[model samples]
Target chain A: MLTYEPDETVAHALDPRAKLAFQVAFAVAAISRPALAPLGVLSLLALGVLLSANLSPPRVLFGYRYPFGILCLSVLIAAVTIGPPWIDLADGVRTAHAAYGVGLVLLVSAAYVRSTPVRHSRAAIQSLVPGTPGRLLGIGVSLVFRFVPVLRRDIGTIRDAMAARLGTERSATERAVVLSSRGLTRAFVRADRLSVALQARCFAWNPTLPPLSFARADGLVLLLSVVLVTVPLW
Target chain B: MSTDHEYDSVALVPESIVRPFARAALLAALTGAVAFVSIPIPFSPAPLTLQVLFVFLAGLYLGPVWGSVSLLLYLTAGGAGAPIFAGGHAGIGHLFGKTGGFLWSYPIAAFVIGALVHGRTGFGFGSIDPTADETPSGGFFDSLEVRDPATVGLGRLVVALSVGTLIVYAIGAGYAMWLLSLSPVEAVAQFVAPFVIGEVLKMAATIALVRDGRYELS
Candidate 1:
């Protein structure tokens, strides 16, 4: 999985806010300029981002196989003509260019994902948006990150137990109902227990979060992001 | 442990908000976990996923406000790189990619489903008023109000889920068309048509799950 890993790479040292800005800027540049030349330059920058994060392009590509597959399929569908000329090469090329743009954007994000931790991301959000909304989002996001693995295990157990009993032979609706109901039941149970724990621990609205500061390198990254954001205008 | 610290200084999250928030977060996590559970359809390239089924349940169970909040948390967590998007793909990039439209529509769809199922009169837009009309079954915590989803009828659940499904497809197909520059017919054929069977199955599954009386949110 492409998640945060402890590393001393340059991308890892920068502020999460700077990285997030770069992602948004990169996405804007990729989406706005879909032509070959700009995309090629953006592709190199994206690859550079991956290399800086100590990530390989192929690993990221493998993680994105599903979206890539869909993009390829769309390209094929766009190329085939119903009648007359068998294939519209131009149409296929256009779709491919758009897909390539999306792929580049994905690559840039993969770098971000590999380099940044969830706590840093949460701190960035809490600081970016002030007051109650930010607090809710910051805490809620962490809660989700904590519980996804737990709930995933619960669902996996449900599936396994059902399989052991010959539940697969049941109709789709029955199996779905069985799985979902059981899944939901366990989730609520966990929620109830967790709520008690939070109350006991005095879950505060203003807890001390891990500090995030903009280092010297972050200034450079933000400047690069600003430059990327201006590409479409030029 | 630290009685010397000023107890009055800390502003604690109230029991009322804590319970629902925890439920919302868990439901969002459930939605993410289910994304990995893909069942293949014969001809279509994309397999059937139970993500939308949970979307419906989020609405039915959490109601309009918190249900939408749950989905919003899902989106944020996924964007922050939780490896929870379809097929374990995660990043801010997916939020702007071809399928971004469907992903962006989740909160709205949940809100719509919750409004329809709960039979709320107004648009309810972002309101977190759990005390509106539905009587809260006061638990041990005086502020905690638990509303049973079973109170809603089966027909309402079906209609609500159907409308939610339509919203997903409309936004998904429309966005895909604009992004990929596909004709309307082509977009529908490619994006919407293949998933009809899976969608129907999901709707049926959601309805069945909702009607089952064995489980209720505490």
Candidate 2:
């Protein structure tokens, strides 16, 4: 089970609404910039955000590498496919560099979310969808966290079962059959159980109830988000 | 934790009150699953998704209040860095990224749909006595019984869903135009035209499935 531990310094400090607003504003502003310099600055600020939250380099690296891979692919695609379709070295580098700038902005934004708690993230959403009941929102947050570990265990179980069934002499078709039948069934059964549990708990929407509050940290975050968006426009 | 203890807890609730919430959450997840049918859209960040169909279905199934709440829950999960987006990518930024308009409009779209279908004049599922062959049951009893499709037609339900879906498209198009800095006509040409055919097909399917009682069940 993945324990629900909120980081006091980072997660607890900011208002969920404020964090969401700031993130949205920053994402819009950062992605719109044509030049790499602004995004490069934002990438550095993502590092600063990690430092402020006291998150380790390894954690930051974990979220960033896939985006970097995407960035590489986007840049290569832009370089090879766009603008005159030439094999010229200079043109290739230029298009690739522009694509890299867009990718960098995307990477920084992902890092920000990774370092934040999932609960606060949900809170920001609550701010957007007016008349959302508090209990339903809370249950939704809980279910997302709850399901992750359940999914992880099911995957592990499937892998172990597959290994056991696939003896040294097993053919490829037999191995495929074992994986699809045993593994898929295990996953489906777990999902069905989860649905039944949720139903039993009376987890429907209660519209009259209000969502959780946004605190002082949320105000600061909102301010930062506004500044982030306006800075580019100015 | 034990099986006996879990069943004991489950046995306590009256089925009517408990059934709705369970049904709502399940429907929302199913709605998300339905939205995944659209693959590549050829152009535009917005894929031609079954999202509107399910959004309408959620409103119709959960009534006005819970239907909207389910949409909120789905958005919260997507915004919170779950890989549940089109082609499976997530983060708060995705809500503001190139395809931000569709993400932003979901809740409002759901609310409008729900509000349109927010009442029950009658009930379904064997509530009506099938063997009521007593010449319209005199006078007072006639008022209580369902009078077939003429009384509770599916057309009203389809109209309600369409209005809600239109609200989504309006918000989505408006946001896309502003974000992209395109003229109003240009935005419609680029963003709206591509998805029109698919959206119409989804609406027809949603109406057919909803009328057949494919909704409401877990």
Candidate 3:
């Protein structure tokens, strides 16, 4: 449920491209160097990112509870053995260390998600990858953003209608078929209308898009990303 | 009202591309929408979801190229913060997280399913009109025709979906094993064993949808 919110925070003002680069660098660094001291430093950087975006650590942690839980369970699984020594403490610790590194990477990504808008991300993608393929992806992504809610509503209505007709009594496969069949039909109908609308409005391969430019702060962010990527080398 | 004033500057997307592109985007959105509809299994820690069903249908409906394209769009949108990942988690992190293998396998699984079902590449839109045998014109729109999913034999459909399912599990478990430092046995125990029943059920549902023929691309 953590999504981009309109805010005047530092992370929000930075260029999405810079944030994306920083995230990739952070993940690489965290994964490549999973030692305790390096992980501790990365954790602090992740905290800085979360704070800059005005995201609460507890809230982000709660959002990712399921994956985190699985990570924790893996540690236990790593420890268990069937031999005389019954448990491998070193293996458990190693697994936990890797999981912690992954956790920090997730935290950095949560900040990016909280601060960057879909339009900004789309613009960044279009500018990052040039030509017709980029244009298709940019426009295609925007269309997806525009339609997920509408289709979600359609699915909801279908589910409700099925429930009203005592469709819950049916087998699981029967219910799934009914729901998906109705969902696909509605989606195809909507797509047909949407295609007509696009043609009517003269959907072009090259249209003027909202501009995005990297400011001075983004330069510093990019520098930080570069430094993070070089941490393993050092 | 000059007929030639800047009209040529606007390169409009042709109708042939527009229709499939719209359907692809919508299908991607539908994939996201259905992630919210999870059905909890009795003993398994992971719940069964319709995400895979949509992936299968994506291939069966859109053919290889567009089917993969649709899934690529879904992954990008989710990575950019759509609350569409399992349990509504989003961000680029999920793309590289422990379950990232499964997320990454989607497009490939869809592509495999589509290729096996359609029996040819090129989006399965290569003018399959049996009545008209004029070596169909080569333009984008002229050679295009939406093939009916029902036209595919049942055995092919089942085989395609089974292979798709195997690819998903293979990649998913392989990646998890590497990332989580689990033994292969542990990975299968954790990732693959629990979901067998749900996968079969989803395959059945997808097969039924194709057989029903109610949602033809045309």
Using lDDT, give the best candidate's number: 3
C-alpha DockQ of every model: 0.54, 0.10, 0.47
lDDT of 3 by residue, B109-189 (tens): 999988888764344344432213334345434443446778889998999999999999999989878877778876887
Off by over 4 Å in 3: A232-234, B1-8, B40-46, B121-146, B213-218
Q: Score each candidate by Cα lDDT.
A: 0.83, 0.52, 0.84
- Interface RMSD after interface superposition, each candidate: 2.6, 10.0, 4.0
- Compared with the true structure, what per-residue lDDT tens digits does model 1 show for residues A139-219? 999998998898999999999999899987777667777888889889988998999999999987777777688888899
Worst 10 residues of 2 chain A by lDDT: A172-181
Error of 3 at A176 (Å): 1.2
Q: Write the per-residue lDDT of candidate 1 for residues B1-218, one digit (tens) a residue.
A: 43433454666666767888899999999999887886665565556688888888888888777889899999999999887888777899999888988998899999899888776431333323322313323322333233566777878778889999999999988887777777677678788888898889889888767666765545
**2 against 3, candidate with superior lDDT:** 3
Per-residue lDDT, model 3, residue A188, is: 86
Each model's fraction of native contacts? 0.73, 0.14, 0.69
Would you list the rank order by lDDT, best first? 3, 1, 2
Residue pairs whose backbone atoms clash in candidate 3: none
Q: What TM-score does chain A of each model score against the native chain A?
A: 0.96, 0.68, 0.95
